[model samples]
Each structure stands twice: as C-alpha cells, then as structure tokens.
Target: MLQTRVIIILLIVLNIFHETTAYIFDVNYSYKYSTKKTVYSSVFLQQNKKDFRFLAGAPKTDNILICNTTVCKSFAFSSQNEAGFEMLGAAIAAGNTVGDPTYICAPHYIVLPSFRINGRCFALHENFKPIYSLDNRLQQVKAYNGSYEFYYAQGQVGFSAKYVEDNEFLLGAPGVLSWKGTVIKHTDLNIKNILQPEKVAEKNSYLGYAIEFGEYYFGGRKRRCAIGGAPRGDNLLGQVSLI
Candidate 1:
C-alpha cells in the first residue's frame, strides 16, 4: 500500500511540473525598445476588451513611452526641459477602466529661480496629452517664507499616487515633514494635505511609500478610507496607516 501511495504522489508531481513548464515556455508576443542611457524602471499595463497597452518610464531622458501592439510613442513635458529634473515617470496611476484619467509624476522636479525641489505631477488626456499640472510649489514655498529650510520639508509631491474615483486621487510626498511623509487628497475643486498629527522626532519614516483606498463598516455603515505604508516607520520595522 505504501508503494502504491508513493507511485501516485510521483505521478501527481510529474503532472504539476509538466503543466508549469508548458506555461513557462509559452510566449505569444513580445516587444522591446532600444535606448542609449535610459532604463525602463517603472511600467504599467492597461487592457480594454481585447487590446493591451503598456507605459514605461525613462528617467534618464525625462520621458515616458506608451506602447501598443504595433508602435511605441515617447512623451515629455516640453516646458520642463531642464537638467536634474529627471524622474518624470517615477510613478503612474490610472483608474481600473480603460477610459479613466491617467497621471504621471516627476518626484524630483525643481522649481526655477529659487531652485526649490518641489515635485510635480500631470494628468493626461486619452490622447496622452497633459491636461493640467497639479503643482502646489508656489503656495508651499510661500508658506515657508519663499524658501524651504530642511530637505524633508521640500514636499516631493509626486513620489507616489493612487486613483480613487472620478477626478479624485491621492498624492504622496514621502519627503515632507522630516520624511514622516504626507498624502495629498486631490479632487475636482480642492487639494488638501493629510498629515499625521503625532510627530515623530526621528526622520525618514517615509509614510507615503505606497497608498490605496479601502472600504470598511463603522456602525454598520460603509465608510471608505485611505491607507498608506511607511516602510521605515516604527524603528525601521514599518507600519501601515489608515486615513
């Protein structure tokens, strides 16, 4: 009976291995883009019905490439043609559906004249054209008397982002407030910064490393909330905060 059980287990293992190998070896389509010094560090894949599209970030060139089955097109912010302003495609986010608005971020963007390192993000139209910039650098700098004193207060606004609903999303600035991190809620008519009330004397917690939206029940009523991750929080052990 033991011998029979061993044979059955061996057969099952062999079957599973065969299926895995077959799936691994199967390839339907592949695409590659050549670049001189740029690396496709971040990528996003979107699908609609039966069509697939891909978006790749090229930080070195400060550009993004959007590709379909046939061709890939490059995009850049024409007005922001300055050096050291890389990280254009560091973060990308869109809604679950195909027709939803898409956002591309440059987390290290530098404001001119003052050279303040306030990050910027853009919302793209369906044709991949930038509709408007969600920049609060002027207002933020004004609050600090026209200059940022510390590195953490610079407000690298677009380090991370997540889409919640129509014309609404969350933007992360993991460098704000001594790296404790902050999230900005962007709506059609308002932009609000959400900061942690309790201050951590130590720096570099990076609370907004990632973000998402969740729904829960409170008093039997459904409530939606924002969640963020701080991988360096709690003495480098990490923590997730619900907002």
Candidate 2:
C-alpha cells in the first residue's frame, strides 16, 4: 500500500510544472554484486514553512537513514573516506571551513526524498537537460535543434522569450496553444490571457483550475458541471464536468 501511494505521488508531481525555490543537497549511492546488478540511491533536502522533513526509501531495502552532519551512518563503508574528502574539498572551495556532511545512506534503498508545495515536487529523469540557463538572451537563439511540445491540463500558461526566436509561437493546430496573431513583443507576457481563439475553440484558451491530485468538487456537489465562456452561439465553448 505504501509503495503504491509513492508511485501515485510521483505521477502527480511529474504532470505539473514548477520553478526552483530552494537549495537541494543531493547524496548518491551505488551498489554492485556478482549475481545482482547495481542499485541506485539518492537523498533529498526539503523544507516546509519553517521546519524540515527527512524521509528515506529504497526499492530493494527499506532500512534507510537521512541525517545531518552530526550523525555518522554508513551503507557503503569502503567509499566513505574518498567521498568524505571530496565533499570537504568542495565545501572548502565554496569558502566554508567547518562543513559537516548530510547523507542519505542505505544498504539497499527504497524511495527517493521529495518535498511538495502547491501540489508540485521536484523530480527529473537522469538525462534531463536544462534548455535555458545562460543569462544572455542572444545566445539562446536556435538553441534547440529539434521540436518540443507543451501539454495543458489546467491553469494559466506563461511563455518565455528564451525558446522563441522572433518572439512568436503557433497556437492550437499542430500546437494546442499558438500565438493568436502578431509577434509577441514582450517575451515576459502571460500568453494565455492574450491568445486568440482556435478555430475549434469558442474563446481564447483559459484553464480554470490548479494542477493537483485530490477529490475535486464542482457546483458544491459531485457529478456537477460548469460551463465556461459567454453564452453566445459563437462564443460558448463546452462544459467542465466533475467525475
């Protein structure tokens, strides 16, 4: 039952979008044996309001420990000296003389650490590439060599100038949301509010809910529906039904 919940939590978080808000301290572990393949492990650093929460899980084993610098625990004892020295060197380079190491140590770990805010958690694939990070905008031109896509569930959509070349994007046909008409002069503008209607849609696209997982209610009851857009024959779009 616990493992099942963990899978659902990961799915919900991956479906939503989030921007970074806090520093993440990550610890990695690897294991190998003659008969069995190596296993992967990691620790997460998370914050809630003013307090912190630490959790440890592993698929192969469940006896995991998440502790701060003062605690001395070990999973792969052989790697301790080398990993410790390397971490200390990194801290020294960052100008910290007295640094204690935080660790996510386990023999066979189960779950990855995570934190949630606004129904989203930080999760990414091993090969995830950051498309935009450089401060200069001019260098971002033609940075992507292939096509990318965006899918919407609910909530406002914001577009950035980093991915756009001439400050324009297509909406709704090949893409679900395209620029209404003109080149977007302000790259920082919220495109959802200013987008033009698609031929099939009655109004400019607007999603009225936050991306989340839980029981959702409509019209204060289950099985109720709400209509979006004005009631003109040309403007009326469709219904949002609660299941």
Candidate 3:
C-alpha cells in the first residue's frame, strides 16, 4: 500500500511539471507569479511605447467569463479652468472628478524683487483657503464616498514627475527661488458604489473664476524674483468627460 501511494504522488508531481513547462517563454517577461493570463496587447493610441501592456505568459483558454476585479465607480473630470482659492472651494463643494494641470507652475509661493506695487517688500491678497477634504476640513466633513484607499496614494507609481528647476549647484542667489500668485487644482475620481453613491448635484461649474494672490519677502533684496503672468487655465472649463 505504501508503494502504491508513492507511485501516485510521483505521477501527480509529473503531471504538474508537464503543465507548467508547456508554456512558450517570451523574451519580454519571465514572471513566476503570473502565468497563463490574458493581457490586452492592443496599444492605446494616446499611449507611448513605454505604456505597453502584455500578459507574462499564455492566455488562459476559457468557456466562462472570469475576472479578478470589477471596475470601481469613478468620475473622470476634464478639470476646471479656474485658479486660486476658488479651485479648492469648487472641488470640496462639488464632489465629483477634479484634475489640475501641471501645478509646478501654479502660483504656490512668491518672493519679492527690488520693486513693489504699493507697500511691503511684497504684497499678498488672495491666500483664502476654505476648509475641504484633507485633515484641515470641518469636523463633520468626510470624503463622502468609499473609505480611504490604501493603494491610491502609493507615491507616484502610475505617473512620473519631471523637475524643471535650474541646477542647484549653479545658482547666483543664496537660496532657491520662491514664487507665488494663483493656484489651481483639478482631479479625476470615482465613487466606490454607483447605485448608492454620494450624489453631487448638477452644477455648471464647481469653482469658476476663482483667483488667489500671494507674495513672499526675504531679508534684503540683492537678487530680485517674481512669478507673474503665469499661464492661465485651459482644457478645463465646463468640459467634463467620463472614463
């Protein structure tokens, strides 16, 4: 009886080995974790070669539908075209999808140069920040949707950031340059459950014509710095798109 059991175990092991090695290896990937899975290889026209997608191995033959996940409820906003405190307010008040263009140039901080329009080294007017969804919002305020996602803010994985600042070692001033003016924010988001999801009322625009103005001043002004006439918002307006 023990000899029979050993023979059966050996046959099982060999069957498993045969099934595993039947796969045709591709030079692109050799995944031990993912095998025999279907991956969409048709590239999106808007995507670059860097965005190619492929299964680690063979596509599974199936007669029935099977999926590991369901598409999460979502809203894909084209982003608002306004800037400054208005942008933040609109996002909070009109909960849907928000997306801001390149915020690196958004008027975040400002430094005064050798000149000023009126008084103070630099003058700031629009720093008005209304309470919203971050840790700073009102006590009763919540995200109004699904609980916070652990993987959503996982440190810039899907997208990449490019630094446009000048080389730090080769600078004329003592410290880095500071700038300020207006700031804009927009994003794309999805409600976890659409059936009973939070309903954001139908509105023309959340935060429109919003503007923020601020300034920065340091001790003395050997070097002058100011960031005015920054690029205005575009592609946001009332153009809302669904993903």
Candidate 4:
C-alpha cells in the first residue's frame, strides 16, 4: 500500500510538471501561501508579451482568471483590452460569469515611483493626469483614484508616497520635506526612493502610471513592484519614515 501511494504521488507530480512545461511560458506564483498555476504563451499587443494567466481559486472551482493573451477567458478574440481584463477580474471577485462588456470598469491604481523597494516613479495628477509641480527646489507629481493618491518627488530629496482613504492606516512623513497641500483625509501615506532611479525610474519620465498590471519588461525584464494594500484586509498598516 505504501509503495503504491508513493508511485501514485510521483506520477501525479510528473504529470503536473509535464502539463505545465508543455507551454512556452510556465510560472508558478505564490499568493497568500497558495500557489497559482499559470501555463500558456501568446502575445498581448497592448502588453507585447506571451500568453500568461493568474489563477485564483480552489482546484475544482478555480474560476478567477487573469490572462494577458488568448488563453483562459477570451473577453474578446485576440484582444487584451482593459474593459475585458476588468470584467474578468470583477467576475472572479464576485464569483460570477462575464457580464456586460460595457460595465463600468474599476481603475487599477498605481502610484509610480512606487514605494515598494526598487519600484518605478512617475508624476501623475489627482485626476490621473500627468502634471508637474515645482516648489523651491523640490519638484513633484501626483495621481489619484477612489482609494489613494500617489506622488513622486525630485530635488533636494527623491521618493514616492501614498495617501490612502482606508481608515486606520497612516504613513507619517519626516520633517525633511513639507506636506503643505499633499495630505488627504482618512488616508495612509508612505514614501520610498528608487533603489536605482537612473535605470528604471529615469527611463519612464511620464507623469502618469502604466495602464497595465504586469511585470515591467523595460530595463531587461524587471518585474514591477506590487501595488494595492495588504492582501488580506486584516493585516496591520504600518508606516515608513524617511528619517
């Protein structure tokens, strides 16, 4: 019996490997201790990448699907549009099938010059527009959505910061710089600098955030820092100080 079980497990492992490896791109990502199985390869003209899907769900009910190319849910044949992607994400989140393709899409907020250790920077405005502001010697840009506002600053100090609308979350700033008009009510804010600005941040001098949520292929295949708040809402909200 023991020998039989061992052989069965080995076979299953080999089968999974074979199935996944059969595709041109295979990436096993871990989210919240759960592994996301992605297997496929195609080009998303918008993203210019091979097919890839981020699956979220249990084995049998594995319904949540996020694919870049024509792999999992085809919102439109050979078209990886934002509307389709948002529909797919919402469908999975609501545990429902694809609905009206014209449904109001949710904006994926990304404050560039990301606060994540080694992330990109941008000068987005409150309305998601790209605007530039200079103060004395410090210059900054901002972008905002329903939940948070993000900024990228350069001059005496260089860093990124966020102001979230969620309650009980706050990121205090050091006395090094002024926060005269950047503060938002009932929001958490934090800032960090680009580890290597010259390479990644400097490359994209745009004032707005990237439209997609995937790895940043620029600078030779570097992954973009993760946006959004805590995975589980229960996680503690901590602050990062510049001092």
Candidate 5:
C-alpha cells in the first residue's frame, strides 16, 4: 500500500490563454515509496497549488526503507536536463571509505568495492551533463550530474539503480517550474501505476513482478503527476506517460 500527504502552500493564476501548452521548467524534488509483500507501488503527484510543478515517481522496490525493518532493493532509470550542469559520479563514491575497490565499464562505467559495511556502501554512475553553466551557475551551487541511491538495513536487502537521462527532466533550474507552462487543469484521467503492467495481469503468468499493495489517503489531500517517456531500445523510445 502507499501513503501520501499533500499540503498546498500558496495560490496561483495562469498568465495566458488555454492554448499555452503546460511546461515544467524546474523541479525541487521527486520521490518514490513502497513496501515488501506488495512487490510494487504506483505513485503520482501534481502541483494543485500555484508555484509548485508536476513532480512524481514510483517506488522502485516493495520495501519502504523509511520503516527501518525490511530490506529494500530496486533500480530506477532517469536522466537530467540536457541543458543543465550536473556532476557525474565521483561524489557518491566519496561518502564511504569502506569496501575494497573493483571497476567495470561494460553495462555502465562504474566502480564498486569488494566488501562494505553500513556507512561504507557506495556505487558510482554518471549523473548527467553539466546542469548549470560554469561561469554563471557553477559558482552559486553544485548538483549531481544525476543521482542513483540504494537503501538497505542488514540481513537481507535488495538493490536500486536509477538513470537520469539528460533531457528527461521537467522542473526548471531552481525557481522556475518550466519555460513552457506552469498552470495546471485537472483531468479525470487516472495516473499510470508504475508497479503494474500497462496491460492486465493473468493468473500463473504476470508481467514484471508480483506485489501486494494498497493506498491510504483520501480527497482531503492533494496529489500531482507529470508526462514523459522512456527509451524503448534500438534507437527507439516509448510513448510518453504521466509520472
């Protein structure tokens, strides 16, 4: 099951005609949540209030590490803004001084240690290209090229990896939501569940993985959603869906 808490902070009004296609210029944060037995979680969020932008994500695993009980493992695929400046991989590899070193460039150019303990876990991958300009933005702040974070407790834990495609971003740099459009109009269309297959599931044979889950929260709270696409393969990409 999934639990969501949405708080609207302010008000907003559109500045153009209905014809202006909505555009997300910048993003503050996007996150996912999940649990163990359920197997998958379908999550979505949107900016019902003014100023906020459409930002949402699906929990990559069945365990919600925030509980601190069951272990969690999963991977995510994403990209940073092609026009933004972001650090590649060195930062993540810096936090821990544990494990022995080993490297590989096949699937992706990455380096991992042979063994690691808590406070010593680490994995490195490219973040995205530079997100901000060196001359104008680098001096003010520094962000990762992209981020791939893994969470676990002990005993048994899963895995997680996310790829942030350069142009697969929606929010604007820092303050701007989008150079395109910020205002939103709600549609009765439901969100796409990330944990379930787009097609219906059948007995004995299922798509992806199996999970038991449910959601907690009612219309009393607010939600958000975004539209995007993933690369299918062979130079072809998939259709755009709400994230």
Candidate 6:
C-alpha cells in the first residue's frame, strides 16, 4: 500500500510538469509583430503619468518604434544626409524615473564633411521628441603640409549606453584606439572618457563592450561603482573592471 501511494504521487507530479511544459511551448498564444528579416534589436519600456509605452529599435530602417497599447509610431533619424549613417537603434536607455529623457544611439552614424565615424546619440524629451544630440559637434583642425584637416571622434560612440543619474550617463566606444575600447562619462556640464588603455598590450581587448552600475561592500563599507566588461581582454578570457 505504501509503495502504491508513492507511485500515484509521482505520477501526479509528472503530469503537472508535462502540462506546464506544453503550455510554455505553445505557439498559438504568442504574438508575431514583423514578418521581415529585420532585427528588432533593442527594446525599452517607459511609463508616463498612468500609461506605459513600448519602444523598439529597428536598425535596418534607422528608425524607432514607439508603441502604446493601441498602435506603434515610427520616428526616423533627423539627419539622413550623411552617408553610411546607419544602425540608429543599436542602443537605447532611459532616465531613472518616469517622464525623464530617453536616449537612442546609432553606433555607425558618420559625421559629414570630415566623414568621421564617431557615431551619435539623440536625447528625446519626455514627449519622445528629440531635443538635441548628446555628442559634441566640435571638430579639431590640424595643419598638415600647408593644408587644414578636420578631426572628430572616430571611436564609434553609442555602441552601448547606461543612465547614471540626473543629466548624466555612460557611453561605450569599442572601436576606439584599435578596439581597446573606452567608456565616456557624460553629464550636463562635461563629457570625458573615463576608461583608457593602460598598456599597448590591451589593444583589441574591447574594454567597454558593456557597462553597469552597482553597489558593493568593500572594507565593510558600501560603495557605488561603474563596472565595465572586456570580453576580449586577457587573450579572450574576458575581464571586468570597476570604477
């Protein structure tokens, strides 16, 4: 009798597990948005006063889709005259709270005239309208052989981004300095690179491939730090740095 009871309980548990797995794998309950071969790349959710919005990046078209419960609207890049300015929605980040600004990045955006490939990011207002670009538009001029040449950021900025605080964020440029990578700390008043290649051997390490902020205990005290991932560091063994 004891053995028979144990068998009945085991059969009941197995039946439950089978039903749960079948439900999870059912395709009839899923929703399909696009039939094209485009990647919906990045996604973000924003909350307004009482409503929520869904934002998706469509890199193939250089556009962003802002969706509510009812419909989705497309917003195209404002500056399209520059050649090779692609991948507008490669990265997306939002402010800490609702109604805060939204950031959208295009890691392949090319600067005109000089044709620099520093990439660009747009800051959207609370209403999802672009306020301005976060990248500095200044270009350094150099005199070479009696001719003037313009130089801008060629580090491929906007490959990754994260919101830190009010009017502050971090941007990644994995292509900077022969793919050694670097992270930029941007605030309302200034923007500067916080990560640099410490040695020539660090090249191709890709230090700023990803980043995040977290709190950790050190010396029995809690401290906040920015963490960066170098997936190709140390002969592809990968490394994580804290700042």
The whole-model lDDT of each prediction reads: 0.72, 0.24, 0.20, 0.25, 0.21, 0.72
Query: Which one is best on TM-score?
Result: 1
- Candidate 2, position 117, lDDT: 7
The list of candidate 3 runs beyond 4 A from truth reads: 1-14, 17-243
Model 5 agreement with the true structure over 44-110: per-residue lDDT tens digits:
1212223322111222211111111233333333322232211122111111111212110011111
Q: TM-scores, in order shown?
A: 0.78, 0.17, 0.13, 0.18, 0.16, 0.76
What residue pairs clash in candidate 1, if any at all?
none
Q: Per-residue lDDT of 1-243 in model 2, one digit per residue for the tens? A: 999999999877765533233425433542211213323233344444554433232323322333343442323222222212111000000001112122221211111131100010110111111111111223112222264312221111211111122222211111122211111112223444223223324333332211111234667865422222212223434333111
Identify the superior model by lDDT, candidate 1 or candidate 2.
Answer: 1
Badly placed stretches (over 4 Å) of model 2 are 1-201, 216-243
lDDT of 6 at 171: 80
Error of 3 at 11 (Å): 4.4
2 against 6, candidate with superior TM-score: 6
- Which regions of candidate 4 are displaced past 4 Å? 1-5, 8-11, 14-158, 166-243
Q: For every candidate structure, what is the RMSD over all alpha carbons to the true structure, in angstroms?
A: 4.2, 23.1, 25.0, 17.8, 23.3, 5.3
Number of clashes recorded per candidate: 0, 9, 11, 8, 49, 0
* Regions of model 6 farther than 4 Å from truth: 1-32, 35-38, 112-114, 126-153, 199-201
List model 1 lDDT by residue over 123-172, tens digit each.
76555444334344434422233655344336677788888888888888
